[model samples]
Target: MPTALLDLILPPRCAGCGVPGALVCPRCAAELHGRPACRMPVPTPPGLPECWSAADYTGAARRAIIAYKERGRTALAHPLAG
Candidate 1:
């Protein structure tokens, strides 16, 4: 389906902040984009490869993840991936 047509029926909203408009508002997108850092959990599991993340699992980033993974907002996958 055409994106414009789909949006007309279910308006796009920022996956992170729930703001109307873009799937991820400029502010949230900026927040999600950052230097990748090693965010290994405590007591690293055996054979776990080094994990790097661009944004900490909190605030807008956390909300976005929940929306994509838990809430079934699959449309957010593209923005969140970036």
Candidate 2:
């Protein structure tokens, strides 16, 4: 499979910091969880889906999303969901 071949050629790396070994490092993962809190939008957009954010969109959390989506690091979904 193309994915399998690519895996062999490229070592797994954290989507957050690009550290080889894991899809998302433990530290970056920890940043994704906390007491779930309600999030509001500025001016409160109409028909916005009710959702909660694990952390503010910055640093590791931001980078991880970009990596997972743009770089195809699907493995990050587990940690990002934490």
Which candidate number would show the highest lDDT if scored against the true structure?
Answer: 1
Predicted candidate 2 versus true structure: per-residue lDDT over 2-82, tens digit per residue = 543666788877777879887778887777675676777777889988767768767888898887788676666778776
Off by over 4 Å in 2: 1-4, 47-50
Q: Kindly report which residue pairs in candidate 1 clash with one another.
A: none
TM-score between model 2 and native: 0.70
lDDT, residue 38, candidate 2: 71
* Tens digits of lDDT, candidate 1, 1-82: 7554666798798887889978889999987887899999889999999999999888899998898888777777888788
Report every candidate's CA lDDT.
0.84, 0.75
Measured by TM-score, the strongest candidate is 1
For each candidate, give its TM-score against the true structure: 0.77, 0.70
Error of 1 at 25 (Å): 0.3
Cα lDDT for residue 61, candidate 2 = 85
